[model samples]
Target: MSPVAGTVLAVLLSLVSAAGYALAAVAQARLAASAAPAGRGALRALLARGQWWWAVGLNAAGALAHVAALHYGPLTLVQPLGALTLVAALPLGAYCARRRVTRTEWRGALLTLGGLVGLVAMTGPAEPGEALSLREALIVAAATGLLIAALASGRVPRRRGDTGTRGLGHATASGIASGVGSALTQTLTAALALELPGREPVWWQTALLAVLISGFAVGGLLLSQAAYRGGLAAPLAVVNLSNPAAAAIIGVALLGETFRAGTWGWPIAAAASLVAARGVVLLTKGGAPAPEADPASSTVVVTGSRPVPPPRATELPAPLPAPLSTPLPLTVPLSVPEVEPARASIPG
Candidate 1:
C-alpha cells in the first residue's frame, strides 16, 4: 500500500478506536454510581457489573485497534489523535447514559478538539531510533513506581468536602499510570515482534509482560473509575491529555524520537495545550453531572421508558380541624321532659 493509503487506514482505525473508547467510557461512567473504592471491594463491584464487563470488552476492542494504528502510523500522529476520545465521549454519554451536554460543555469539547488539531498540525515528523533498551526500561519502571507511590499515598483518601479535588487526584494518578502502561505496552509489543520471525519468547519474559500488562490495565482502570466518580470533564481531560503527553515523553526518551521544530511549531503546541486546559475548566463549570437514576427511587406513576425517574411526591392529608374551644349550642333540649303516670288507669 502507498504511504498515503497506510496513513489513511491508520487514521480511520484510530478514530474507530476512539469511538469504541467513548462508548466504553459512557458505559463505565454509568456504572460509576455504584462503584466502590479502588481495591478488592471495588474490583469485586466492578466485576459484578454487566456494564463494566461490556465496557471492558469495548475497551479491549479499542486497544486492539489502537495498537494496530500505532503499528501503521507515527506516534506523533496517533498519540495526539487519541484525544478525540474525550470529545467523542460527550455525545456517547448523551446517547448511552442519557446525560445532557450543555452548550458550554459542547464548546469546551470543540475547543479541545480544535486544540488537538492545532497540536497535531504543529507537530512535524518524528525522528526514528533504536529499539528500547533494558536500561531505559528500568528507568521508566522506576519512575512509574515512584509516581504510583506518590499518587496512592497522596490522593487515595476521599474528601467529603471536595470530591472534585479527589477526582482530579485520581485522574492524574490514572493518567500517569496509563502513560506508563502505554510505554509498557509498546515494550511488550517490541518483545512480541521478536517472536514474529524465528525467535521464541523466553518464559520469564512472557511472565513479566503478563504481570505488567495486568497490573497496568487493571490498576489504571480502577483508578479511572475513581476519577469518574468525581465527574467527567476534569478527569477525562486529564486522561486525554496525559496519555499522549506521557507516551510522547517516553517515546522521545526511549526511542530517541525527536520533533522537527518549525517556525511556529513549539508555540502552537504550547498554546494548544493551554486551550485544551481552558476547555476542561469550562466543562467543569457547566454543571455537575447528574447521577444515573436509582431504580429504588422510581415510582409506579412514572409514565415512560426513560431511565429511573425522581421519587414520586405524595400529598399528606390536611390536618384535622382543631377542636372547638367553646361547646356548640344543641338543637334539641339537653334533658327529656318527664311524664306523670296515673296509678290505676291502665288496669281497666
Candidate 2:
C-alpha cells in the first residue's frame, strides 16, 4: 500500500482502538460502582456479570486494533495516537454510566492526553533491536512485579466516598504491568518471527515470555478493576499515562531507543509530565468525597412543591408544665364545717 494509504489506515485503526478502549473503560467503571465490593470473591462476581465480559471483549478488540495500527504505521505516529483513548473515555463515561463529567475532569483528561502525546512524540524511532534474552526478561519481570506489589499493597479507599488516592496507586501498578506485558509481547513476537540477529529461537525463552505476558496481563486487569471503584477519570488517566510511559522507558533502557530532540527533549518531557500530574490532581479534586450531612443541622422536609424547614429551636413550642410531683391540696377546706342537723325537728 502507498504511504498515505497506510497512514490513513493506521489512523483509522487507532481511532477504532481508542473507541473500544473507551467503551470498555466505561463498562468496567459501571461494574465497579454497582457490583459488590472487592474481596476474595470479587473476580468471581465480576466474571458473573455480563457487562464485565463485554468489557473484556472490547479490550481485546482494542488491543488487536492497536497491533494492526502498529503494523501499518510507525511507532512514533501510532503510539501518540493512543492518547485518544482518554479523550474518548470522558464522554463515554458521562453518557454510558449516567455520570456527569465535571469541567475539572474534562480539563484533566485533555491535559493528560496532551502531555502523554507530547511525551511519546519526543521519542524518536530506533532501529529494530534484538529481543530480550531470558536473563533480561527475568530482570524486567522481577522489577515490574516488585513495583506492582508495592502499589497494590496499599489499603484500598472506600468505594462510596474517597479521593481516589488508593485507586490511583492501583491504576499505576496496572499500567506498569500492562506496559511490561506489551514489551514482552513484542520480544516474543520478534523471537517467534526469527527477527533476532544470528540466533535461532529458543523454545524455553519463548515459553517464559509467554508465561510472563499472561501473568502481567491478568494482574493488570484485576488491578484496573479495583482502581475503577474510586471513580473513572483520575484513575483512568493514571493508567493510560503510566502504561505508555512505562513502555517508553523500557524501550529506551532495553530496546536502544532515544529521544528525538536529544538533550532538549528531556526537559520538555519533564514539563509535560508535570502538566499531566497537575491534571491528575485536578481530577482527584473533582472527585472529592461528598459532604456528609450534619446531624445537628435543621432538616428540610419536602412538602408539595417547596422544602419546609423544621422549626428552629426558638420556634418550637414550650413543653407543657411538668405534671405535679405531689398531688395538689384538696380544694375543699381540710376541715369542712359540720353539716347542720336535718329537718327531722320540723316533722316532729
Give the best candidate by lDDT.
2
Clashes of 1: 0
Scored by TM-score, the top model is: 2
TM-score of 2: 0.83
Writing each residue's lDDT as its tens digit, candidate 2 over 85-185 gives 88888888788756677888888888888788888888765466556665677899999999999998998755545655658889999999999998888
Candidate 2, lDDT over the whole model: 0.83
TM-score (all chains, Cα) for each model: 0.70, 0.83
RMSD of each candidate relative to the true structure? 10.3, 7.3
Residue 172 lDDT (model 2): 97
lDDT, residue 324, model 1? 38
